[model samples]
Target: MPYIEVIHPDEAEGRLRRIYDRVTGPGGQVDNVLQIHSLRPHTLEGHMALYKSVLHHPRNDLPKWFLEAIGVLVSLLNDCSYCARHHAAGMKRQMSGDTEKYEGCLEQLHRDHPGEPFSDAEQAALEYARKLTIAPGFVVVADLTPMREAGYGDGEIFEVNQVAAYFAYANRTVTGLGVHTEGEALGLFPPDGEEWRHG
Candidate 1:
């Protein structure tokens, strides 16, 4: 349950009801994170749009699994287990349940350093995310050099930046609001495809 009052999916009406329809999982389930914005449905719409554009859209060139991994790392850094668990499940699904890859990502999430299973480019991106999340004000233009040296194009660099920043925003949203996964379908993802997938 969230700290603030929220309109349950079933009890919603008008604009909120319509938005609920688009994001509900099987059995009309909605993540508490989404419901946190129930008092202001427009913000939920904005959040959904930003989430899709940065982390789940088809045009994003960065690997989807990597994006989800970034989400996990950021959530962990912010101590937002609500997102960490959900996205770890999403990452596993994205990798098609490859145990080795999933475990590797789990291990990698514990530290922000470059290591086995992650390419040089990926390490640099992870480092960037760490700095951006831990201390965004300290991030300088030179910080992007490592990613550029590792062969990431400006577009791909932008993708990494957005994922880190977006997850940080999501983390604050979850932690600050006292949100939880009490009844959420942990692995259901990409918002519009909400369903009760076991995680």
Candidate 2:
């Protein structure tokens, strides 16, 4: 149960109803994270827009699965089971055809150790995420050297940073609000063929 009342999709009106429709079109279900912002529907709208732009934008330099991996890592570092479990499921869905890789990634995250299963770039990115999430003040320009060497340009680096930073905010929101997963998770794949529109 959530700390506050969440507006169910079926009972939403106006903007909230429209956003819920987009999130649960063709029989999809609304996750608790979105419901947390139900009291302020515009915030929910903003949240979804930022999420899609960061993780689902077509021009994103990093793969969706990799971004999801970062989300899981940050959530775990924060000890946020809600975000971790949800993103882990999303990561699993992204790697659906290759169960081995998905399981390997989860195991690596669980151990808090980056090993052979992940590429050098992924390792570097994960390290950056760990430091940023746990100690943002300690993050210096030199911290990005490995990522640059791993072939990530300035824009890609920014994207990774933003994703990690966003999740930190999201994880805190879920934790502070005592939000529960309630057996509801967002879909692993993008909705509406990759083009998200605002109402």
Candidate 3:
């Protein structure tokens, strides 16, 4: 159970209802994390504001899909199952329900060899995310040159890094707050197809 009693969608009001509409509009459904947030609407509002500012920042060029992928990866590293599943659902939606590609990204990185088949850019990015999520103090100038060599400008790399950093905070908050999961929502994803194979 959550630290505070989570409110149902029908019961939310004031700022909570407004935030809920923003999060779950156009036939969208609220996730358990949002339900948990219904207990403290102001913090939820602040979170949504931060999320929007980072995700839709005008100067950023990183595709939302790539940023979301990094978020899933970071969530996995953080061992936050709710975030992992939620971000994976977002990635699935962004990938047009390409579950294979989403899972393939994970399989590729799990290779036994030190340097696997991923591109220099992808490898550098994964390494950077790992370092930032696992050990922030160790991230340094030496770690960033690879991203630069991979053609990411300073601003772009900063955006990527900040997204990774932010998700680490998100993962902890969601987990610590006892956010629930609806694994069935993952059924919306399938390996392939116009109609979902599962769910």
Candidate 4:
């Protein structure tokens, strides 16, 4: 249960109701993360917009699966099981039914020190996410060398940075609020299946 009383979708009105409607899917399902922000509906709108722009934007050079992996890694490092489980499921889906590969990734994530088994590109991104989440102060321009060596240009690197940074913000919000999975493992959704363009 949430620490504070959240306005359930059924009880939403006016702008809140519209926001709820936009987030709701075919089965009348809304992500728990969104529901957690129910008390501040405008913030929820901002959150969703940022999420879509970061992870679902068509121009993103990083594969969707890799972005999901970064999300899971950041969530795991923060011990935010609520976000981890949801993004792990999203990552698994991106594996194209390769359950074994997904399991291997999970094992890697669960290790005391992860990333050895992954490619340099994955390791670079994961390392960035780890540092950004756990010790943001230590991050430096040199820390991005591996990602650049892995062929990520400034834009791709920016996307990775934003995705990791967003999840850190999100994980803290969920953690500080005492939010739990609570049988809710829904992934973030894009509004109307639309992608936001970057300048």
Candidate 2 local lDDT, residue 8: 88
Model 1 Cα lDDT, one tens digit per residue, 128-184:
998999999999999999999999999999999999999988999999989999867
Q: What is the lDDT of candidate 2?
A: 0.81
TM-scores, each model vs. reference = 0.93, 0.91, 0.80, 0.90
The Cα local distance difference test for each model comes to: 0.85, 0.81, 0.67, 0.79
TM-score of 2: 0.91
TM value for model 1: 0.93
Model 2 over residues 1-199: C-alpha lDDT tens digits?
7778888877899988888777763346777787789999989878887888887787888888889899999999998998899888878777756889988888888766576588998889898988998899999999999999998899989888989988998999899888887766444445434444321
Question: Rank by TM-score, descending?
Answer: 1, 2, 4, 3
Q: How many Å off is the CA of 40 in candidate 2?
A: 0.6
Model 1 regions lying over 4 Å from their true place: 191-199
Top lDDT model: 1
Model 3 lDDT on a 0 to 1 scale: 0.67
True-vs-predicted CA distance for residue 105, candidate 1, Å: 1.0
Stretches > 4 Å off in candidate 4 = 185-188, 191-199
Tell me the TM-score of model 4: 0.90
lDDT of 4: 0.79
Report RMSD for candidate 3. Answer: 5.9
